[model samples]
Target: MTAIAPALVPLLVTLPLLGAAIALIAGRHRRVQITVSVATLTVVCAIAATLLTVVDLGDQAIAVSVGGWPIPFGIVLYVDRLAALLVMVSSVVLLAVLLFSVGQGAVDNDDDTPVSIFHPSYLILAAGIFNAFIAGDLFNLYVGFEILLVASYVLITLGSTESRIRTGVVYIVVSLVSSILFLSAIAVIYGALGTVNIVQISQRMGDLDQDTQLVMHLLLLLAFAIKAAVFPLSFWLPDSYPTAPAPVTAVFAGLLTKVGVYAIIRTETELFLFNDVNVLLMVAAMATMIVGVLGAVAQAELKRILSFTLVSHIGYMLFGLAIATPAAIGATIYYMVHHIVVQTTLFLAVGLVERRAGSTSILRVKGLMKAAPLIAVLYFIPAVNLGGLPPFSGFIGKFALFDAAAEEGDPLMIALIVAGVVTSLLTLYALMRAWNLSFWREEDDSAETEARISYLGDAPAASVSTERRVIPRIMTSATVGMVGLTVALTVFAGPLYDICARIGGALLEPVTIGQLEQEHEQSTGGDDKGEER
Candidate 1:
């Protein structure tokens, strides 16, 4: 809570990057590479968690002006309760993925899995996410974006197998175009307002005509929309995400797009101010929910279906922002965190499913109950949670969100709320269909057993029978870990929800964000106030 405590922001972002550099240089020494990378992330998470605690102590935002200079001139690292909370949540998620990615008995690298640069690439990706969450300026955030984008490029293409490479190409092109759009948006904001600091832009945007502000705001939202995979701009998601390795795809589904949502939340509440964009954002949220779930229903592949669900869930976050009330946004925060874990765990479970079934295509995979009952449980928990089952965090989060909306008394919001319920139901039905087909039937090895290889399971040893079994340790382990996290979320629901409320409060009124901008402007003494460079 003290000045010294808040300064951990830079180190949190920098340390993992430092380790990533070490990994890239010493990649051949796999042991050292993994050790350094994991240590760095562990420390980063610790610092971030500490910061979150300090923020909970009500010290407001913890900001350190880098280089000992004030905001605008030197980079500022700001950690609000919201940023700190996300940093912590994301850190845990990424860490879990790291555990599964780097630990022994994970990944089939020795056999057929190629391009497993799980060490260097994963660390850098975590670093970028940290930087993005805490960055105090738009350009600083841009740097974070690039860092993650580049790392993701590597992660997606790792092993460079033909299919992986193909997915990587789609990812690269879409990402490049999004980056360009982001840069252009930033340029426009900088050119129009003479400042790239998000807080300053928010403060000054009111000076411009409403039309100009609208255009600029829409452009900025456009960039995040693309990244977040909102409908119409979401074509890139399903094409590329489901094709990557399961761990990579799980992390992407869980973290990458959510980062974009985080950005939009920051922009709407702190920069462009979504106060007046209610109608548009509300409509967009409804459309995103409907379209996304529709796509999910139509998908035949396990990962692809989850990917569609990922896009559909983005709508919930947007709904919170659109509603812009403390209660609604608070619930949105809870929803965001809940969805991240649920989605990530579900995707990881699918990985387990793929291991046991030898395929991810729903049509090709069947009889998981007969072939691997553990995979059935692995698949079911998250599916049930996603359906908003009670005793799970998903229900708590959605209940809060709906409660907030119901109090609004707007017929439109009421309708949107109905749409949300329908979406959740349809999502459940979709998952159920897949579950029934995969887990209910027998190993129709009423044909050939070897012909039905369990690609989703670990390579079998001579001792492990190739028969239909209800439990697989590896599959069970992944499912248990996931279920454990969800249960923790449920048990700690009050405290976690409290943290989210604080985050919503801090984000809604970003005074520290403003202070940083003011500090920057005073440090620069307005010599560079010209609109254009």
Candidate 2:
């Protein structure tokens, strides 16, 4: 089983790329494209699940050197508890969103997302995400980002309407700037250390002067901060995300920024464990939380509100990361997983609300609780979960984070805790307000609704009405499946959090190049022995 596990590492990436090629070729046949994409991600999910189980039960990281090359000279794919869990969770999210998109396309006559182009690009994006999670070298990680950038530009601009096109351009330019910074950092690292292999860099990072180390560190952080949508660097996200198709926005909200967070995790924990940036990061976390939620509060449109909250919640993860303790890191991982699931589910629910109502503007839409109770329930579950209400995964994750921060006993940590709590309350208020306006208020109570809207002064320009569309059962099913998964996060929190705690402990203890090389030899030698037998 161990010997075979090494072989499966590459398939996590290769299968999706192969499926993408097939999906592209079969684009003319919509059914074929759908089958290929779904089957591919389903299989990827199974593989990732197997890997997560293997890595967890074995209690060790798995490393594969591609094409039989030696470690430090080859592209290595590494999966420990963190990477495997993320890949598994990501595959599940990708598959669910794919189904939701399929349903949307079917009902919309493939106008919003043309299956021929969408399927291929979506699979490619999946490949990029999986690759980023498992990447063992800086260069390889950069490649993953580039692949995501290319595929996302295509996905985000589907239908090429003026708004999408404009947003896509902004997304592309921001992404390219970050990529350039990342590439430049890689070059500098390679120049200083003679290699881009992550393990080797960690082993050698201490040899550099403190100033040089700080320079490299800041460059990497700046680049990743932009990707992760950390404050001041997060300006592009709220504007960029809401313009895409529902599936595109959902997946982007759920997975893309998390990839950036993942990179920051690797950078801080693996490469520069002793850095002094925690204070800087904590300040940014506070600002991101306060600023993002404030933006959400001001937005009149549901999508835009979700978009800003998306940015706000990112700060929570950053807060945990800035705390830089094992418990905090564990909480961060749990929160990240929680956010990915809950955020995507919320977006999917909003998509349903949009279909049932004519607009996502709470001012224009009304009485969904009476009109479409299922959509109301669907949106409510994840919305409150995101708002950090108790008994849900959001609350559990936030409590764990706050508990960890309190243990630190630092004033800044306390301030961040206060910011996080305030952010949570505001998130609840904003979402529930939307719910009240869109779902609770009677449609005929226009006078009352308008009276309420008058308090906003000028925020109702985006509240224009449009024709409502029919809601598809598959779309609802997809959302229900995601909501169930979100609930499972709380149901299974004990074991899942045990895993995350173990990952946090393991991540702090960086594996060296020597350890990785020896493991590679042992696995390959065992495979040879099996062949001989």
lDDT (tens digit, per residue) of candidate 2 on 448-480 = 657867655466335545568887889999999
Q: Determine the C-alpha RMSD for candidate 2 after optimal superposition of all C-alphas.
A: 2.1
> Over 4 Å off in model 1, which ranges?
1-3, 103-107, 110-116, 444-479, 512-514, 517-533
Go through the candidates in order and give the C-alpha RMSD of each one to the true structure.
6.1, 2.1
lDDT scores for all predictions?
0.76, 0.91
The TM-scores, one per candidate, come to 0.88, 0.98
lDDT of 1 by residue, 240-296 (tens): 887676678889999999889998888888876633687788888898899999888
Instruction: Kindly report which residue pairs in candidate 2 clash with one another.
Output: none
**Best candidate per TM-score, number?**
2
Runs off by more than 4 Å, candidate 2: 526-533
